[model samples]
Target: MENYFLGLEAVHPSCLAKIITGDKLPKKAIIWEFTNEIKPIDLYCYLQVKYGSPNGLQNFLRNDSSDNLIHWEWSLAGQFGIVSIQGHNFRTEVHLIGEHDGKGLTLEDFIQQIKADFKNHGKSMKSVRVELEKWTRFLNPYHRINSVVAKNIKSLNSLDVKVDEDRELVKFHEENLPKLEENWKYVRDKYDNAIGITFGLRSMLPVLAESFINLIIFVLAKPEIKKNERLLQNTIRQQIDIRVQSLHLNCIGFTRPIDYTDDVCKKFHTLMNERNDLLHGNVEVNKLKIGEVYFKGKVPVFVGYEDMWQSAMGISLSSVKYNTIFDDHAVVTNFIEFILDHLSKDLKEQVQYIMTNSELGYNPANGRLGSLFSDNIADFRVSVNEA
Candidate 1:
């Protein structure tokens, strides 16, 4: 079993020395949860037992804060329990302590901080809470930035324009973007050095990046509805316009163009409402037995991968407003592959034109490219000519 220790930290060490941890209103505790089971010492000992290591449990009581550097001592663990600890700015602090020692940043300081808090609460300084599941699942809060960055990289890779065309979009958004990548190295270290568990780093980060870029495509393709941009705007009046445009079902453009045609638009209106129902909340599903009921078997099937994840966790996105920013990104990896497959054809030429010509403009969901990339857009690619 993996032993995980989550340390609570106040804003400053002076704040910690003054009072108790987790005792008052508005006292924010940033929990630093760490997991390890490799050493001879048990998890509980590392947490509750005091006096052996430099930052061992007892050292948090020292009235004087200054002391020689102890790798596993108060500096590392004592940061916690400071209810009013004040500082203008603070990074993870994981990087700032004892950085030169080859041991890497140890949890000793964090441990001492927690111990101090234990003392403040009038509780036994020799005890700590070590959770197995929460600590070891590998939910690295530290990785949040890097994961987002990886997504950005993938987003850039999926732009639907020729090399010269993509350069234009890059030139536009690159400068306007914010630098969200602060403390990106913590993520790098955890992925590189942490032990005892397998966490798939590439899973959601890549998907997030792709999904974001796809949403952008959908927004860009809004002006051109003939190709299925209507599938996205999917409102009643909008759907009808697309249907009429696609099938020329109604000569709305000419035949009595000015007259209100609710009759012609009814089917679209109903479907549009139904689509809203399905996308916005729980969808009722039932199975029918046709011809013969073979042995009366009963089983369950969850719809959509995201839906399944939600079901398992009792959390869902049905009511959440769809982010238009991510519309075309969902289909990018596939579309990029699609572009690769058609790189030698009329399609590729069209992409180059749409992407390169500032007048043409580029949309990830450009209907012309969507048809070719359809769904799976990542399988093919002979490096796009860079702008």
Candidate 2:
């Protein structure tokens, strides 16, 4: 039950003051700062392990390379609120407020969680501790501005003018820091709704795909069901008791089933296997190889890990081989497109409505989903066309 105070400013102090004063909509807030000892990619992995793919309850996302920041918040059923990791040059700072619920974990607990997650991922924890210690030093009350001024030294350059201004600055920071915390609730809610769309699609794609298959079965079996109503009804009830994959295969077989060799279906099957692996806790990182020079030390687990955190992806001793899955977000997009291309006109409209309603579509879904097929799936279609 330790108290954690908000610290530092990424934007100008005056701009932050304006935000606290409600003169401007605060574009962002600061939570923690660290030198190059801690990398953004490590933070990204920490998030993936902690929250498991941005389900709004514990959602997070990294910005583009230009921004080089990760935006996320403590979302344990309304515990901690919005937070951001801002990186500039070789330094990074996590900025956030403790406004939402008093039950959020203390700063020490959160730091320990990171250390544990890092060590569990087969990485060293000593470096993590060193960087965290720096954060503690920065936040130390003994070294605070208020304390420095209290023990006035004659060597201070602008003694009279600066001291008076410093006192007022301290007063301003104290008065408005709590006010900024309250204002951030609105900002956090907006990001949560947007992240929810991506999360929902990932979880719901398989169900939607199965629904399309079921529709196909319903249409094809209509004549049989009509002819032998009682018998067909019993058979249908029995079929419903089977596994989803079997049902999907049976429905596909009834309709001109796409073969295992077909590229789209092949990819879809691979995605389904990977999704099942994830759901069942069988996910693993594929061993890393750099050209002819084999590296047994490293493994690629998450989509961006190979690109961002190569060092942290290493295994000190053992070698374990595993199959790779496309990024979960990529899998969702490809799966939806696969279904969209096969469904009937009336069915397509229903699928569109399901995905694009105010609940899912309120934030990012409309623009993102609309562009997904056009921008991403279009390329796949081009290769098929060429073939």
Candidate 3:
């Protein structure tokens, strides 16, 4: 029921002049925009150190991820505002907007609070940079700028009043963001480990793609076989292919595979072949389109690097394109989604079904299938839900 508003914009020349003169404080206005080179995850962690809990702020801080950047707003009574945080990798941007209620500390005060607490968290003032800027203004009325800012502030609010006002979502996000942060940190540290070595992302990409593909196959197949059977079975990949064919078929609720049509089937087979080559063979980079590299096989064909990267990152290829060689996580993710629309359908039916029904969740037994299934599902679910 508590509502908060925050708006932020990059600093412009006019805003800089105002900041230098102290002509406008964050308290005088309803919104403040801050930019810093510091990571958004670090900032949120900083806020938790300063503010005690993730719940103290909006859902933006709780759900912002590499794939799912978040923005939010709220308004009630005389108070109105919005706050947003968006991050990609380590880079971050923030915006806050609202009506100034006389009861609390000003936005400037909050920024200073962030700066002071940031220091305790091993961040410097320069790293936790904050600024104020007006990104928009009403052209017709000069005197009504304040009124314009405050007017219909409720419209900016994104409480999702239609669905328990995001309580379940808020709880889910609060519980998972830190875990996501930790997982990404692990990945980042692993990546950083390669810094001193001769290894490049190009070679790593294929390995990552192979891992992702095997992971998906393993998750789809784990429930049907026991640990020993999983390891002992020589036909694990064949079994997984059959199950995936079934799941993909069942996902569309079709007697025969529909979405996994002939074209998709061909693509899937090709993708599997490419994954196999990357895992087992020497890959050759295309001289012209390094991004579209391949392994020499029965036939030489270029892999869809853009499609795989976009699929892995859950984003589209940028308008600007270039030739770069790398196997991508997107290929695996996109393939999974391509089959099931989202991993949720596959997990709820395949993985969660086993967990809820079979001995997997009942007994706290450690196994390769169980561990991989649980970890990957949890991670994928969080990412999908956040998305």
lDDT tens string, model 3, 97-119? 33344557455554554555565
**Candidate ordering by lDDT (highest first):** 2, 3, 1
* Clash totals, every prediction: 33, 7, 15
Over the stretch 81-106, how does candidate 1's per-residue lDDT look in tens digits?
A: 22111111111113221112332334
**lDDT tens digits by residue: candidate 2, 1-387:** 332222211233343334445733333332445554546556645554544433321123444322322334322221243444443434444445334234554445545555545766544334443343121111222123212322222112212322233223323365756654453443334323333333333344444444434433433344445356684455355532242224334332232333445565556565556446535666354523332334546953443333211231222111111111114334445554654555556655655544432221111221112111111111111111110
The numbered model that scores best in lDDT is 2
Instruction: Please report, as a residue range, the 10-residue window in candidate 2 with the lowest summed lDDT.
Output: 373-382
TM, every model: 0.17, 0.25, 0.25
RMSD of 3: 25.6
Global lDDT scores for all candidate models: 0.31, 0.37, 0.36
Evaluated at residue 262, the lDDT of candidate 1 is 45
Q: Candidate 2 overall Cα lDDT vs. reference?
A: 0.37
